[model samples]
Target chain A: MSGLTPREWLGLEATHNPHRWYLPVIPRLSVREIFLFGGAGLAAATTALEETTERPVVWATAQYLDFAKVGETMDLDVHVSVSGRYTTQARVIGRVGDREIITVNAALGRRELDLTETWPTPPDVRSPDACRPRGYDYDQDSLGKHLDQRFAPTTGKKLGGPTGHGPGRLCVWTKPPDGVGNSAATLAVFGDFVPMGISNVASQPVGSNSLDNTLRIIDVRPSEWYLLDIEAGGIANGFGHGQLRIWDDQGNLQAIASQSVVVRDRLKR
Target chain B: MSGLTPREWLGLEATHNPHRWYLPVIPRLSVREIFLFGGAGLAAATTALEETTERPVVWATAQYLDFAKVGETMDLDVHVSVSGRYTTQARVIGRVGDREIITVNAALGRRELDLTETWPTPPDVRSPDACRPRGYDYDQDSLGKHLDQRFAPTTGKKLGGPTGHGPGRLCVWTKPPDGVGNSAATLAVFGDFVPMGISNVASQPVGSNSLDNTLRIIDVRPSEWYLLDIEAGGIANGFGHGQLRIWDDQGNLQAIASQSVVVRDRLKR
Candidate 1:
């Protein structure tokens, strides 16, 4: 689409044995690539040597690595030590200009059993189309092209956006095209979505940088639409905490994410 | 301590369910206050609870219920339900301002014995007093006040008092001032130390805000000093990720902590 070959548009940071992948922190592609890579890895791991995918694969636990500029290529290789019965593990490397920008270790697994008694009831709320987007315009610097955010309520809406005097929850739909598979590529994609916990909610007109992002995939139910139920609270000084639960179309809880939040407005020394 | 005594600090939300707590958001506290509440709860959960606590209390997902403000005294309560052989579940509530500020469902567990394995080798490292702290000054906002962050570098230099950077791995000594015993109250205190995973490293000078903190009590080795080999990667687009494997002074892997990080600067934004 960018008038370049697949290899030219995005390069794979791959190598053999002691498998390795390298990706750049390009401003334009770094974040999206990481999500796609992570998500793809997980998808790849789940289905085995399955069919090549073309549809937008739905996945979760997308965290930001580093920013790749307008023209940097990222490399993603898989280090599958053990693709075990119930689970598997993969390590990722993201690089830019000889710098390994991000490295991730992700655990891949299939939905083996049902925890009906323990899990929370899915929120009986609005559809993705009903919710309006907020954080995208918070600050231009905080927004990314790769993220297609759709929130029913906009930033100015004082109430009903999840936190209004009501239930501080917001429903968000993030579309990272390459982040919906089970391969190392899938893991790389999903790992970049961790910031959506805030990006989809409070950070509009303001954005904060994250120090670390971690995701644990509880179940694997891949889909075309990745949904996030993001919420935040308990802000004392300036930092607080929040969580994101990713569900597929069937409304099954696929993965859950949590992170320490640094409210950008309060942290500017 | 107020005119209401325990009743003064007590208030339930409209969504309050006797079997479960639904918290409204607290608007007074800044982001920092939420962080303090989370850290305090971690310490309280880790050190206070006896048999019903999550082994390592790996923070799975922490969702902010509503807007929480500062200066208000927040009350947090935890109910342990079903302590399974491998998994333990708990209901947590955070309250303030005539409302429950937040509620969470936490799952604590030990490594499933179905897949027995070996812990990693203790890095050839130094003693706690050997390294300097890598983070910035500790204030009421940091988890450090609740922890004793003493480092002994086996491979890297002493961290430069909180904000400096070092190796991918390091060793440190941590202990809750009030020991976590075999009691429910103690579980509250045990989890406060899990955030040290990033503060001990010398990469970015960002304060930590935990979204969801999870820990697995490895051995529960009785000791005055614990060893933590913290490693984290997957830092893309400003968001990062990390994990820590804690060992008793005896080199036993006593616990494992993994957290998703939001990178806000020290003073907080």
Candidate 2:
């Protein structure tokens, strides 16, 4: 039997319908698939709620449940829990018909003007084209080609010695061949960097995919370049934590996203 | 009179001691300020861990416990809540000499090769410059000049109805003023996109500023034009929620962000 492609499974519901799509979980897709799936759910939720309530997507946070495979179809669902003129809330889940794959809670809101507190700016660098590309052993694979990256000048070219591999703060321009804009595409982009931090600081290039991913998108221009300044600390063994600053050229200061990633020991670039 | 910056307090034995920063409290900065100060504490922690453990920041999630302010000096006190080879966890606090301003728990990990997953790609659109520069209602008196923005072809151009706002995904090219990378410049660039999600979508051109900011730099980059793709939703009580995707020009996804902004009301352009 012909199995459903990822896009086919995703298209099951209209943008406004609050439902989950469950197709055979592709083992290859893993939680990484869930990351984008969750993003798709978020996209539907944002679009539906905004049009229905005449609002827009403000912020959302989600967790991945488990690895999914391609042959088995999973259940995808979304619920509009709270709907207000200025904001809306949703709870979403994905399951393998019975076994759950992921759960998400997203909030949507109307635009408002207020004075709150936010992050400051980072340092400067040249345009993406003018910058040097730090080649990695993995650059030869899908991870490298699907990117449009430009690194800052202050940073070292490749990964290196202890002192935690490198300093806090890294900026690179990235996107799939599609450029930037699509929500699911963003997920694909972020998941790619899950290893850059480790690769830069480690003496040699290392590779690790996200076990589970979490993201928080701050307000920013969809058409402008985004700067990701990252910092990490405390890696005694294989696992550790990192923080990131997602910014745009317009000075809109976006949200902060943080999550836990699993390190696969055998992989190398 | 003597003045102290967040960095200065970080230098003092009482405040700098990773074991003893959040002891005192100053009320003017408010509980929110305390939470932000708590952010400062982690900023310091992230800096130190980078030097000692030398691991790439793979994952980090921090919640604001309280808030702090500009004029007063705050402290950073840290404790290792969990330690492992793959990850190390730390809990740190920010305080005003005697009172606690904020607290946080963060995770760090090692780096390696990334696994699989694919997400949706955006329907290609024209470059951002095709759009015009739009004027926003946000009071960017401080950030206006600091931010170098050129909106989408229709940025400030006239459009009808609020019906077309889309999480369908949009794009922009962004850059900050020169010399904003290291020192305090890094924070400034990250801080600028705080309200970009809203600004990117609003029919009337509204903007949000950064307030109560949190940043996690997973990768470090100098300065470059990072692509920012954002989606806004969950509008209620004049407040909105949105997410941001940061990419390099080559279409590599680098960072993801989200924020909560108050969308006071919609207006016709």
Candidate 3:
């Protein structure tokens, strides 16, 4: 919050209380921005606690309760529940006045070990420049406009149709706004885009409101673009469940994320 | 806690306080039993709160902080963080005296909606009776003896060897001990077996200790065998991450579960 980098321009301002932070929901960062802040803001507060303990976060899960709208300011308060030699467990509560918006549980630690391998190999797809640039004409207010994305070769152009032709999966090359650098906070922001896969495989126009966004930080490497491989596992009884793997340009798996959302049929609405 | 069934024998004894429960780690319930208790105990406490609220739990996540050993009794305290018309957010802390073993955050609701579908089809495999019974002989003290399992045809007989020959996955028919019924609490207990796949595919003897177990409950049906389709996403930087889809005998998807674990090379140890 001090020397503002483009990434820090998430509008997260530190408060007098060291454990607390505030974020104002700006227009560009509003709609899907909730997912970004729901993850990034919570990660920011958790990261702040890391400064004192000097530990890196291994995992963080944000349970989203309510949505934050444009012009609304959200408050994030982090409390370290337990601190051990190698790990720290913390919880962050995000609120808008009396209403709670989100709650994040985080585990932080940095212990080096020899075991290392990524089982899922990145698909050999065309470079980002070769694919069509993804647009937000479907939802004019989509936060997709804030970031740049190129649909992967396997992806279809339609929003809602039959995706059963293949596994319920979608891949996209997502890049944060210019000047934003790759970091845990940025990865958390980018990992929440899996719900788009629900609509991608839907039979009609449907929107999903995520109940939780769980990000398991692996290793964030500096790169211009992040590859998000999303698999929508199931959609049943008004809810949709999915998992996403965030990979760096070098094909290093950075983080694993999963979520459950309340799916609403926009066309029926 | 009263008139207990085999499933109820999770050894979760209720206290005078309505919001509190205790778990005694017995022989059959030791080792991985702690994870079962960590999830089931929290679900028990959350379900108790449901008697008054009449809402079923939709999702629950347990973060493993410390180990609850044999001969030790753990306490589960449930705190309802927020209660809404269709949803309730709560947290349960499991502790042994001053030491916290696990923390669970749950979302409960009873909203009925028409949208229903499971994208992932149940694998076409041999029935439970046709497959060979799976057991654990490596660890004499293994809690696996308490339940019954049948290995899927696609799974290899070797526990720790290369598994890249097939899809990075494993399927098993898991059944709780006698008298245990198919309940959400039981499903919670059974959803934590993804680690078996690690050893199933590992080239060396490796043991995985889960850091977190997250279960997203869908629909529970009456069935003798629960199909666990586990996919080992990756093992990198000393950690292994995976997801499991729980299905009933009728091929109805019940829950989607995921976990992150710290892998230890037992042969080296």
Which candidate leads in lDDT? 3
lDDT of 3 by residue, A150-226 (tens): 76754334343232235677778888766677666777777777688777866567787777788777786778788
Q: Between the candidate structures 2 and 3, which one is better when assessed by lDDT?
A: 3
Q: Write the per-residue lDDT of candidate 2 for residues A1-269, one digit (tens) a residue.
A: 11332244233334344353333434222233333333333333333334444444454444444444545555656666556555555555666656555554455554444423332444454555667665545322332443456675533344422221235335665433343353432432353353566545543344444433444554534534555555443232344334454555454545444444554544442
Give a tens-digit lDDT track for model 2, residues B96-124: 65654434334555433342221213223
Runs with alpha carbons beyond 4 Å of true place in candidate 1: A1-269, B1-37, B43-61, B64-90, B97-103, B108-117, B129-143, B155-166, B178-204, B265-269
* Candidate 3 local lDDT, B73-146, one digit each (tens): 88878787778766777778888898888877777775545666666777655788888887575554445676
In model 3, residue pairs whose N, Cα or C atoms come closer than 3 Å (at least 3 residues apart or on different chains), thus clashing, are B159-B199
Chain A TM-score values for every predicted structure, listed in order: 0.59, 0.66, 0.87
Ranking by lDDT: 3, 2, 1
DockQ of 2: 0.09
Question: What TM-score fits each model?
Answer: 0.41, 0.44, 0.86
Deviation (Å) of A134 in candidate 3 = 3.3
TM match of model 3 to true structure: 0.86
- The share of true interface contacts that also appear in candidate 2 amounts to 0.17
Error of 1 at A2 (Å): 16
Docking quality tier of model 2: incorrect
